[model samples]
Target: MNFKELRDLFIREGAEFYNQEEASALFYRTLDQLLGWSRTKAVTSLDKYIEASDLPKYLEVLEKLKSGQPIQYIFQETWFYGFPFKVNSGVLIPRPETEELVHWIIETLKGQNGGSLLDIGTGSGCIAVALKKSLDGFQVSALDVSVDALEVAQYNAAMNKVVVNFIEADILAYSGTESFDLIVSNPPYIKEDEKPKMHENVLAHEPHRALFVSSENPLIFYKAIADFALVHLNPQGLLFFEINEYLGKETVEMLELKGFKRVTLKSDMQGKDRMVSCSI
Candidate 1:
Protein backbone atom coordinates (compact mmCIF):
# COMPACT_ATOMS: atom_id res chain seq x y z
CA MET A 1 0.00 0.00 0.00
CA ASN A 2 1.09 3.54 -0.62
CA PHE A 3 1.66 6.05 2.17
CA LYS A 4 -1.52 7.93 1.26
CA GLU A 5 -3.64 4.80 1.50
CA LEU A 6 -2.13 3.83 4.84
CA ARG A 7 -2.63 7.34 6.18
CA ASP A 8 -6.28 7.35 5.18
CA LEU A 9 -6.80 3.93 6.73
CA PHE A 10 -5.14 5.03 9.97
CA ILE A 11 -7.35 8.10 10.21
CA ARG A 12 -10.47 5.98 9.76
CA GLU A 13 -9.40 3.22 12.16
CA GLY A 14 -8.07 5.64 14.77
CA ALA A 15 -11.13 7.92 14.71
CA GLU A 16 -12.83 6.01 17.52
CA PHE A 17 -9.72 6.28 19.74
CA TYR A 18 -8.16 9.64 18.82
CA ASN A 19 -9.09 12.83 17.03
CA GLN A 20 -8.13 13.35 13.42
CA GLU A 21 -5.11 15.46 14.25
CA GLU A 22 -3.98 13.11 16.99
CA ALA A 23 -4.25 10.09 14.74
CA SER A 24 -2.37 11.86 11.95
CA ALA A 25 0.48 12.70 14.31
CA LEU A 26 0.60 9.17 15.65
CA PHE A 27 0.65 7.74 12.16
CA TYR A 28 3.52 9.94 11.08
CA ARG A 29 5.49 9.20 14.25
CA THR A 30 4.96 5.48 13.85
CA LEU A 31 5.94 5.69 10.21
CA ASP A 32 9.07 7.60 11.16
CA GLN A 33 9.98 4.87 13.61
CA LEU A 34 9.29 1.95 11.31
CA LEU A 35 10.81 3.53 8.23
CA GLY A 36 13.46 5.69 9.96
CA TRP A 37 12.24 8.68 7.98
CA SER A 38 11.54 12.16 9.24
CA ARG A 39 8.06 13.62 9.02
CA THR A 40 9.21 15.85 6.16
CA LYS A 41 10.63 12.84 4.41
CA ALA A 42 7.40 10.93 4.93
CA VAL A 43 5.42 13.86 3.55
CA THR A 44 7.62 14.66 0.56
CA SER A 45 7.62 10.97 -0.26
CA LEU A 46 3.92 10.41 0.38
CA ASP A 47 3.52 8.43 -2.80
CA LYS A 48 6.17 5.93 -1.71
CA TYR A 49 4.82 2.41 -1.35
CA ILE A 50 4.90 0.42 1.93
CA GLU A 51 6.02 -3.17 1.72
CA ALA A 52 3.23 -5.78 1.81
CA SER A 53 4.86 -7.37 4.87
CA ASP A 54 5.19 -4.00 6.68
CA LEU A 55 1.42 -3.32 6.45
CA PRO A 56 0.66 -5.91 9.14
CA LYS A 57 3.27 -4.39 11.43
CA TYR A 58 1.59 -0.98 11.22
CA LEU A 59 -1.84 -2.54 11.82
CA GLU A 60 -0.58 -4.36 14.91
CA VAL A 61 0.75 -1.13 16.41
CA LEU A 62 -2.56 0.59 15.76
CA GLU A 63 -4.40 -2.23 17.51
CA LYS A 64 -2.13 -1.92 20.51
CA LEU A 65 -2.83 1.80 20.69
CA LYS A 66 -6.54 1.05 20.40
CA SER A 67 -6.03 -1.36 23.31
CA GLY A 68 -4.71 1.56 25.42
CA GLN A 69 -1.01 0.74 25.51
CA PRO A 70 1.07 3.93 25.58
CA ILE A 71 2.94 4.68 22.35
CA GLN A 72 6.19 5.24 24.23
CA TYR A 73 6.16 1.70 25.54
CA ILE A 74 5.25 0.49 22.08
CA PHE A 75 8.44 2.11 20.80
CA GLN A 76 10.37 1.11 23.94
CA GLU A 77 11.68 4.68 24.15
CA THR A 78 10.80 8.29 25.02
CA TRP A 79 12.32 11.75 25.08
CA PHE A 80 12.69 13.68 28.33
CA TYR A 81 14.25 17.10 28.79
CA GLY A 82 15.34 16.72 25.12
CA PHE A 83 17.20 13.48 25.80
CA PRO A 84 16.14 10.06 24.57
CA PHE A 85 15.59 7.31 27.16
CA LYS A 86 14.49 3.71 26.84
CA VAL A 87 11.30 2.74 28.65
CA ASN A 88 9.01 -0.24 29.25
CA SER A 89 6.35 -1.55 31.64
CA GLY A 90 9.12 -2.11 34.16
CA VAL A 91 9.57 1.65 34.71
CA LEU A 92 7.20 4.58 34.87
CA ILE A 93 7.29 6.95 31.89
CA PRO A 94 8.88 10.20 33.01
CA ARG A 95 6.23 12.88 33.46
CA PRO A 96 6.39 16.57 32.51
CA GLU A 97 6.03 17.61 36.15
CA THR A 98 9.11 15.59 36.98
CA GLU A 99 10.90 17.51 34.22
CA GLU A 100 9.83 20.74 35.90
CA LEU A 101 11.24 19.51 39.19
CA VAL A 102 14.53 18.77 37.45
CA HIS A 103 14.51 22.28 35.99
CA TRP A 104 13.92 23.77 39.43
CA ILE A 105 16.86 21.83 40.76
CA ILE A 106 19.06 22.97 37.89
CA GLU A 107 18.11 26.59 38.47
CA THR A 108 18.67 26.29 42.22
CA LEU A 109 22.16 24.84 41.86
CA LYS A 110 23.49 26.80 38.92
CA GLY A 111 27.22 27.64 39.11
CA GLN A 112 27.78 25.02 41.84
CA ASN A 113 30.78 22.73 41.74
CA GLY A 114 31.35 19.07 42.55
CA GLY A 115 28.31 18.56 44.80
CA SER A 116 27.11 15.02 45.27
CA LEU A 117 23.41 14.20 44.86
CA LEU A 118 21.52 11.03 45.76
CA ASP A 119 18.30 10.09 43.98
CA ILE A 120 16.14 7.72 45.97
CA GLY A 121 13.61 5.54 44.18
CA THR A 122 15.08 6.58 40.85
CA GLY A 123 12.87 4.41 38.65
CA SER A 124 13.99 5.62 35.22
CA GLY A 125 16.95 7.68 36.51
CA CYS A 126 15.56 10.60 34.48
CA ILE A 127 16.14 13.11 37.26
CA ALA A 128 19.60 11.80 38.11
CA VAL A 129 20.79 11.68 34.52
CA ALA A 130 19.36 15.09 33.63
CA LEU A 131 20.99 16.72 36.63
CA LYS A 132 24.36 15.20 35.85
CA LYS A 133 24.03 16.26 32.23
CA SER A 134 23.26 19.88 33.09
CA LEU A 135 25.49 20.53 36.09
CA ASP A 136 29.19 20.62 35.56
CA GLY A 137 31.54 18.90 37.99
CA PHE A 138 28.65 17.36 39.89
CA GLN A 139 28.39 13.89 41.35
CA VAL A 140 25.08 12.06 40.94
CA SER A 141 23.95 8.63 42.18
CA ALA A 142 20.57 6.91 42.22
CA LEU A 143 19.07 4.00 44.11
CA ASP A 144 15.93 1.99 43.40
CA VAL A 145 14.32 -0.82 45.36
CA SER A 146 13.35 -2.86 42.29
CA VAL A 147 15.88 -4.80 40.27
CA ASP A 148 13.82 -4.53 37.09
CA ALA A 149 13.44 -0.80 37.47
CA LEU A 150 17.13 -0.46 38.19
CA GLU A 151 17.94 -2.26 34.96
CA VAL A 152 15.84 0.20 32.99
CA ALA A 153 17.39 3.15 34.83
CA GLN A 154 20.88 1.89 34.13
CA TYR A 155 20.02 1.61 30.47
CA ASN A 156 18.70 5.17 30.46
CA ALA A 157 21.84 6.49 32.14
CA ALA A 158 24.00 4.81 29.51
CA MET A 159 21.79 5.97 26.65
CA ASN A 160 22.00 9.54 27.91
CA LYS A 161 25.79 9.22 28.14
CA VAL A 162 25.79 10.19 31.79
CA VAL A 163 27.26 8.30 34.70
CA VAL A 164 24.94 7.56 37.63
CA ASN A 165 25.56 5.18 40.48
CA PHE A 166 22.69 2.68 40.69
CA ILE A 167 22.00 0.79 43.94
CA GLU A 168 19.37 -1.78 44.80
CA ALA A 169 17.92 -1.08 48.25
CA ASP A 170 14.49 -0.44 49.66
CA ILE A 171 14.28 2.89 51.50
CA LEU A 172 11.79 1.63 54.11
CA ALA A 173 14.28 -0.88 55.51
CA TYR A 174 17.60 0.41 54.24
CA SER A 175 19.93 2.82 56.03
CA GLY A 176 22.44 5.07 54.34
CA THR A 177 25.93 6.00 55.53
CA GLU A 178 27.20 7.85 52.50
CA SER A 179 26.69 11.58 52.56
CA PHE A 180 25.40 13.76 49.72
CA ASP A 181 25.13 17.48 49.14
CA LEU A 182 21.71 17.11 47.53
CA ILE A 183 19.14 14.34 47.94
CA VAL A 184 16.20 14.03 45.57
CA SER A 185 13.34 11.61 44.96
CA ASN A 186 10.05 11.30 43.08
CA PRO A 187 8.89 8.33 45.07
CA PRO A 188 5.68 6.29 45.11
CA TYR A 189 3.32 8.90 46.53
CA ILE A 190 0.14 7.96 44.68
CA LYS A 191 -2.18 6.51 47.31
CA GLU A 192 -3.97 3.25 46.61
CA ASP A 193 -7.33 4.99 47.04
CA GLU A 194 -6.48 7.27 44.15
CA LYS A 195 -6.24 4.42 41.68
CA PRO A 196 -9.84 4.77 40.53
CA LYS A 197 -9.12 8.41 39.71
CA MET A 198 -6.12 7.69 37.49
CA HIS A 199 -6.27 6.95 33.80
CA GLU A 200 -6.41 3.31 32.80
CA ASN A 201 -3.47 3.77 30.42
CA VAL A 202 -1.23 4.59 33.37
CA LEU A 203 -2.52 1.90 35.73
CA ALA A 204 -2.48 -0.75 33.04
CA HIS A 205 0.90 -0.04 31.45
CA GLU A 206 3.07 1.60 34.12
CA PRO A 207 4.71 -0.27 36.96
CA HIS A 208 2.57 -0.05 40.10
CA ARG A 209 5.63 -0.88 42.21
CA ALA A 210 6.98 2.55 41.30
CA LEU A 211 3.69 4.42 41.60
CA PHE A 212 1.51 3.56 44.60
CA VAL A 213 1.39 3.51 48.37
CA SER A 214 -1.13 2.38 50.93
CA SER A 215 -3.57 5.08 51.99
CA GLU A 216 -2.43 4.60 55.55
CA ASN A 217 1.13 5.50 54.60
CA PRO A 218 1.08 7.64 51.49
CA LEU A 219 3.97 9.63 52.97
CA ILE A 220 5.97 6.56 53.82
CA PHE A 221 8.60 7.00 51.12
CA TYR A 222 8.94 10.71 51.81
CA LYS A 223 9.40 10.12 55.52
CA ALA A 224 12.02 7.47 54.95
CA ILE A 225 13.95 9.59 52.45
CA ALA A 226 13.73 12.64 54.70
CA ASP A 227 14.98 10.72 57.71
CA PHE A 228 17.93 9.45 55.72
CA ALA A 229 18.60 12.94 54.36
CA LEU A 230 18.73 14.33 57.89
CA VAL A 231 21.88 12.32 58.56
CA HIS A 232 23.24 11.52 55.12
CA LEU A 233 22.90 14.96 53.58
CA ASN A 234 25.70 17.38 54.21
CA PRO A 235 25.08 20.44 56.38
CA GLN A 236 22.24 22.49 54.88
CA GLY A 237 22.08 20.20 51.87
CA LEU A 238 18.88 20.53 49.87
CA LEU A 239 16.28 17.78 49.47
CA PHE A 240 13.90 17.77 46.49
CA PHE A 241 10.74 15.78 45.93
CA GLU A 242 8.20 15.55 43.16
CA ILE A 243 5.20 15.13 45.38
CA ASN A 244 1.56 14.28 44.85
CA GLU A 245 -0.62 17.32 44.18
CA TYR A 246 -3.06 16.50 46.98
CA LEU A 247 -0.32 16.03 49.58
CA GLY A 248 1.74 19.17 48.97
CA LYS A 249 1.06 20.92 52.24
CA GLU A 250 1.23 17.72 54.23
CA THR A 251 4.59 16.88 52.69
CA VAL A 252 5.91 20.32 53.52
CA GLU A 253 4.64 19.97 57.08
CA MET A 254 6.36 16.61 57.38
CA LEU A 255 9.64 18.11 56.28
CA GLU A 256 9.23 21.09 58.59
CA LEU A 257 8.44 18.83 61.52
CA LYS A 258 11.59 16.93 60.73
CA GLY A 259 13.42 20.23 61.33
CA PHE A 260 14.23 20.85 57.68
CA LYS A 261 14.76 24.54 57.10
CA ARG A 262 13.08 26.59 54.40
CA VAL A 263 10.52 23.99 53.42
CA THR A 264 8.82 25.17 50.23
CA LEU A 265 6.09 23.77 48.01
CA LYS A 266 5.96 24.63 44.32
CA SER A 267 3.30 24.22 41.66
CA ASP A 268 3.54 22.87 38.15
CA MET A 269 2.69 24.57 34.84
CA GLN A 270 -1.00 23.73 35.31
CA GLY A 271 -0.91 25.56 38.68
CA LYS A 272 -1.18 22.38 40.73
CA ASP A 273 1.08 21.89 43.75
CA ARG A 274 3.38 19.07 42.67
CA MET A 275 6.86 19.64 44.10
CA VAL A 276 8.58 20.19 47.44
CA SER A 277 12.09 21.44 48.21
CA CYS A 278 13.62 21.81 51.63
CA SER A 279 16.91 21.84 53.43
CA ILE A 280 18.37 19.66 56.15
Candidate 2:
Protein backbone atom coordinates (compact mmCIF):
# COMPACT_ATOMS: atom_id res chain seq x y z
CA MET A 1 0.00 0.00 0.00
CA ASN A 2 0.97 3.64 -0.42
CA PHE A 3 2.39 5.81 2.37
CA LYS A 4 -0.93 7.58 2.91
CA GLU A 5 -2.75 4.29 3.21
CA LEU A 6 -0.17 3.03 5.69
CA ARG A 7 -0.40 6.24 7.67
CA ASP A 8 -4.19 5.90 7.74
CA LEU A 9 -3.87 2.35 8.89
CA PHE A 10 -1.57 3.39 11.73
CA ILE A 11 -3.92 6.13 12.89
CA ARG A 12 -6.97 3.88 12.75
CA GLU A 13 -5.31 0.85 14.29
CA GLY A 14 -3.25 2.73 16.84
CA ALA A 15 -6.35 4.58 18.02
CA GLU A 16 -7.19 1.52 20.09
CA PHE A 17 -4.15 2.24 22.22
CA TYR A 18 -3.13 5.86 21.65
CA ASN A 19 -4.72 9.18 20.85
CA GLN A 20 -4.84 10.46 17.29
CA GLU A 21 -1.87 12.79 17.79
CA GLU A 22 0.21 10.09 19.43
CA ALA A 23 -0.62 7.61 16.66
CA SER A 24 0.34 10.14 13.99
CA ALA A 25 3.61 10.83 15.74
CA LEU A 26 4.24 7.14 16.01
CA PHE A 27 3.61 6.76 12.30
CA TYR A 28 6.16 9.41 11.41
CA ARG A 29 8.68 7.95 13.86
CA THR A 30 8.31 4.47 12.39
CA LEU A 31 8.56 5.87 8.89
CA ASP A 32 11.74 7.69 9.78
CA GLN A 33 13.30 4.55 11.17
CA LEU A 34 12.23 2.34 8.29
CA LEU A 35 12.75 4.72 5.38
CA GLY A 36 15.10 7.32 6.87
CA TRP A 37 12.64 9.95 5.76
CA SER A 38 12.09 13.22 7.55
CA ARG A 39 8.55 14.29 8.44
CA THR A 40 8.57 16.71 5.51
CA LYS A 41 9.77 14.01 3.19
CA ALA A 42 7.19 11.55 4.46
CA VAL A 43 4.44 14.09 3.97
CA THR A 44 5.62 14.91 0.45
CA SER A 45 5.87 11.22 -0.50
CA LEU A 46 2.42 10.20 0.71
CA ASP A 47 1.43 8.75 -2.66
CA LYS A 48 4.62 6.68 -2.99
CA TYR A 49 4.02 2.96 -2.54
CA ILE A 50 5.80 1.12 0.26
CA GLU A 51 8.12 -1.62 -0.98
CA ALA A 52 6.68 -5.12 -0.67
CA SER A 53 9.57 -6.22 1.51
CA ASP A 54 8.97 -3.31 3.92
CA LEU A 55 5.24 -3.97 4.21
CA PRO A 56 5.67 -6.84 6.63
CA LYS A 57 7.86 -4.75 8.88
CA TYR A 58 5.23 -2.05 9.07
CA LEU A 59 2.53 -4.61 9.76
CA GLU A 60 4.61 -6.15 12.51
CA VAL A 61 5.01 -2.80 14.19
CA LEU A 62 1.27 -2.24 13.96
CA GLU A 63 0.59 -5.57 15.56
CA LYS A 64 3.01 -4.89 18.37
CA LEU A 65 1.34 -1.54 19.02
CA LYS A 66 -2.02 -3.25 19.10
CA SER A 67 -0.63 -5.66 21.65
CA GLY A 68 0.21 -2.71 23.93
CA GLN A 69 3.96 -3.06 23.61
CA PRO A 70 5.74 0.25 24.02
CA ILE A 71 7.10 1.70 20.80
CA GLN A 72 10.42 2.33 22.49
CA TYR A 73 10.79 -1.38 23.15
CA ILE A 74 9.78 -2.21 19.58
CA PHE A 75 12.63 0.01 18.33
CA GLN A 76 14.97 -1.02 21.20
CA GLU A 77 16.08 2.60 21.61
CA THR A 78 14.83 5.90 22.97
CA TRP A 79 15.85 9.54 23.34
CA PHE A 80 16.61 10.94 26.79
CA TYR A 81 18.10 14.31 27.68
CA GLY A 82 18.60 14.89 23.93
CA PHE A 83 20.80 11.80 23.59
CA PRO A 84 19.85 8.42 22.16
CA PHE A 85 20.21 5.34 24.39
CA LYS A 86 19.53 1.70 23.73
CA VAL A 87 16.68 0.27 25.83
CA ASN A 88 15.14 -3.16 26.21
CA SER A 89 13.05 -5.26 28.57
CA GLY A 90 16.05 -5.32 30.87
CA VAL A 91 15.67 -1.68 31.86
CA LEU A 92 12.86 0.75 32.57
CA ILE A 93 12.24 3.40 29.92
CA PRO A 94 13.56 6.77 31.02
CA ARG A 95 10.75 9.19 31.78
CA PRO A 96 10.41 12.97 31.40
CA GLU A 97 10.18 13.49 35.17
CA THR A 98 13.60 11.90 35.49
CA GLU A 99 14.91 14.42 32.97
CA GLU A 100 13.73 17.17 35.30
CA LEU A 101 15.63 15.49 38.12
CA VAL A 102 18.80 15.57 35.99
CA HIS A 103 18.18 19.20 35.15
CA TRP A 104 17.74 20.00 38.83
CA ILE A 105 21.05 18.37 39.62
CA ILE A 106 22.85 20.20 36.82
CA GLU A 107 21.36 23.49 37.92
CA THR A 108 22.30 22.80 41.51
CA LEU A 109 25.92 22.15 40.56
CA LYS A 110 26.41 24.39 37.55
CA GLY A 111 29.39 26.48 38.69
CA GLN A 112 31.27 23.80 40.64
CA ASN A 113 34.61 22.88 39.12
CA GLY A 114 34.38 19.12 39.66
CA GLY A 115 32.96 16.53 42.00
CA SER A 116 32.18 12.83 42.17
CA LEU A 117 28.64 11.64 41.47
CA LEU A 118 27.02 8.22 41.63
CA ASP A 119 23.74 7.14 40.08
CA ILE A 120 22.31 4.19 41.98
CA GLY A 121 20.22 1.80 39.92
CA THR A 122 21.25 3.58 36.76
CA GLY A 123 19.00 1.77 34.34
CA SER A 124 20.14 2.22 30.75
CA GLY A 125 22.80 4.62 32.18
CA CYS A 126 20.66 7.54 31.06
CA ILE A 127 21.19 9.61 34.20
CA ALA A 128 24.92 8.97 34.57
CA VAL A 129 25.72 9.43 30.89
CA ALA A 130 23.62 12.55 30.58
CA LEU A 131 25.28 14.09 33.63
CA LYS A 132 28.78 13.20 32.44
CA LYS A 133 28.00 14.64 29.01
CA SER A 134 26.67 17.88 30.47
CA LEU A 135 29.09 18.27 33.39
CA ASP A 136 32.42 17.25 31.93
CA GLY A 137 34.29 17.95 35.13
CA PHE A 138 32.36 15.58 37.34
CA GLN A 139 33.36 11.95 37.65
CA VAL A 140 30.24 9.79 37.25
CA SER A 141 29.61 6.20 38.29
CA ALA A 142 26.51 4.04 37.94
CA LEU A 143 25.38 0.89 39.75
CA ASP A 144 22.73 -1.67 38.90
CA VAL A 145 21.95 -5.17 40.11
CA SER A 146 21.02 -6.45 36.67
CA VAL A 147 24.01 -7.40 34.54
CA ASP A 148 21.90 -7.19 31.42
CA ALA A 149 20.92 -3.63 32.21
CA LEU A 150 24.53 -2.73 32.86
CA GLU A 151 25.50 -4.15 29.50
CA VAL A 152 23.08 -1.84 27.78
CA ALA A 153 24.24 1.03 29.96
CA GLN A 154 27.85 0.35 29.05
CA TYR A 155 26.99 0.32 25.36
CA ASN A 156 25.11 3.60 25.74
CA ALA A 157 28.04 5.20 27.57
CA ALA A 158 30.35 4.27 24.72
CA MET A 159 27.79 5.26 22.09
CA ASN A 160 27.33 8.63 23.75
CA LYS A 161 31.13 9.06 24.04
CA VAL A 162 30.91 9.57 27.80
CA VAL A 163 32.86 7.72 30.45
CA VAL A 164 30.79 6.26 33.30
CA ASN A 165 31.95 3.64 35.77
CA PHE A 166 29.41 0.82 35.61
CA ILE A 167 29.07 -1.29 38.73
CA GLU A 168 27.02 -4.46 38.84
CA ALA A 169 25.96 -4.56 42.48
CA ASP A 170 22.77 -4.26 44.42
CA ILE A 171 22.56 -1.06 46.46
CA LEU A 172 20.95 -2.89 49.36
CA ALA A 173 24.11 -4.87 50.05
CA TYR A 174 26.81 -2.74 48.47
CA SER A 175 29.71 -1.47 50.51
CA GLY A 176 32.12 0.93 48.85
CA THR A 177 35.18 2.68 50.20
CA GLU A 178 34.86 5.59 47.82
CA SER A 179 32.76 8.62 48.70
CA PHE A 180 30.96 10.97 46.32
CA ASP A 181 30.13 14.65 46.41
CA LEU A 182 26.70 13.84 44.97
CA ILE A 183 24.50 10.77 44.74
CA VAL A 184 21.27 10.43 42.79
CA SER A 185 18.85 7.59 42.23
CA ASN A 186 15.58 6.98 40.50
CA PRO A 187 15.16 3.64 42.11
CA PRO A 188 12.15 1.35 42.04
CA TYR A 189 9.47 3.12 44.07
CA ILE A 190 6.24 1.64 42.85
CA LYS A 191 4.76 -0.80 45.35
CA GLU A 192 3.75 -4.26 44.17
CA ASP A 193 0.06 -3.52 44.68
CA GLU A 194 0.36 -0.43 42.51
CA LYS A 195 0.96 -2.66 39.52
CA PRO A 196 -2.70 -2.68 38.65
CA LYS A 197 -2.67 1.10 38.22
CA MET A 198 0.17 1.01 35.68
CA HIS A 199 -0.26 0.71 31.95
CA GLU A 200 -0.02 -2.68 30.26
CA ASN A 201 3.11 -1.69 28.33
CA VAL A 202 5.06 -1.10 31.54
CA LEU A 203 3.70 -4.05 33.51
CA ALA A 204 4.11 -6.51 30.66
CA HIS A 205 7.33 -5.35 29.03
CA GLU A 206 9.52 -3.44 31.51
CA PRO A 207 11.70 -5.16 34.07
CA HIS A 208 9.73 -5.79 37.26
CA ARG A 209 12.84 -5.52 39.43
CA ALA A 210 13.41 -2.02 38.09
CA LEU A 211 9.84 -0.86 38.70
CA PHE A 212 8.55 -2.38 41.93
CA VAL A 213 9.01 -2.78 45.68
CA SER A 214 7.18 -4.99 48.11
CA SER A 215 3.96 -3.45 49.31
CA GLU A 216 4.95 -4.39 52.86
CA ASN A 217 8.01 -2.13 52.58
CA PRO A 218 7.46 0.39 49.86
CA LEU A 219 10.43 2.46 50.99
CA ILE A 220 12.83 -0.44 50.83
CA PHE A 221 15.19 0.94 48.19
CA TYR A 222 14.98 4.46 49.49
CA LYS A 223 15.89 3.40 53.00
CA ALA A 224 18.82 1.38 51.79
CA ILE A 225 20.08 4.06 49.40
CA ALA A 226 19.67 6.75 52.02
CA ASP A 227 21.65 4.77 54.58
CA PHE A 228 24.32 4.04 51.98
CA ALA A 229 24.51 7.71 51.11
CA LEU A 230 24.87 8.64 54.76
CA VAL A 231 28.05 6.61 54.89
CA HIS A 232 29.47 7.14 51.38
CA LEU A 233 28.52 10.77 50.85
CA ASN A 234 31.26 13.27 51.40
CA PRO A 235 30.79 15.92 54.05
CA GLN A 236 28.27 18.40 52.69
CA GLY A 237 27.61 16.11 49.77
CA LEU A 238 24.21 16.23 48.16
CA LEU A 239 21.73 13.40 47.64
CA PHE A 240 18.87 13.47 45.20
CA PHE A 241 16.07 11.06 44.51
CA GLU A 242 13.25 10.80 42.00
CA ILE A 243 10.53 9.59 44.32
CA ASN A 244 7.03 8.23 43.99
CA GLU A 245 4.58 11.08 43.86
CA TYR A 246 2.34 9.32 46.35
CA LEU A 247 5.10 8.81 48.90
CA GLY A 248 6.74 12.23 48.96
CA LYS A 249 6.05 12.99 52.61
CA GLU A 250 7.15 9.58 53.79
CA THR A 251 10.34 9.74 51.73
CA VAL A 252 11.22 13.22 52.92
CA GLU A 253 10.53 12.20 56.47
CA MET A 254 12.68 9.12 56.06
CA LEU A 255 15.58 11.26 54.90
CA GLU A 256 15.13 13.69 57.74
CA LEU A 257 14.97 10.90 60.26
CA LYS A 258 18.18 9.52 58.80
CA GLY A 259 19.91 12.79 59.83
CA PHE A 260 20.04 14.35 56.37
CA LYS A 261 19.81 18.14 56.64
CA ARG A 262 18.15 20.71 54.48
CA VAL A 263 15.93 18.08 52.92
CA THR A 264 13.86 19.67 50.21
CA LEU A 265 11.06 18.05 48.29
CA LYS A 266 10.44 19.39 44.81
CA SER A 267 7.65 18.73 42.37
CA ASP A 268 7.96 18.00 38.70
CA MET A 269 6.30 20.03 35.96
CA GLN A 270 3.07 18.28 36.81
CA GLY A 271 3.23 19.65 40.37
CA LYS A 272 3.54 16.22 41.94
CA ASP A 273 6.25 15.85 44.56
CA ARG A 274 8.52 13.70 42.40
CA MET A 275 12.00 14.64 43.61
CA VAL A 276 13.90 15.33 46.79
CA SER A 277 17.32 16.82 47.55
CA CYS A 278 19.26 16.79 50.78
CA SER A 279 22.72 17.48 52.16
CA ILE A 280 24.75 15.69 54.77
The window of 10 residues in a row where model 1 has the poorest summed lDDT is 10-19
TM-score of 2: 0.97
Q: All models: lDDT? A: 0.90, 0.94
Backbone clash count for every predicted candidate, in the order shown: 0, 0
Candidate 2 weakest lDDT stretch, 10 residues: 195-204
Candidate 1: lDDT over CA atoms?
0.90
> Tens digits of per-residue lDDT for model 1 on 68-187?
788899999888888888888999999999999999999999888778999998887888998889999988899998898899989889888888888899998888678999999999
Native-to-model Cα distance after best TM-score fit, residue 247 in candidate 2, in Å: 0.5
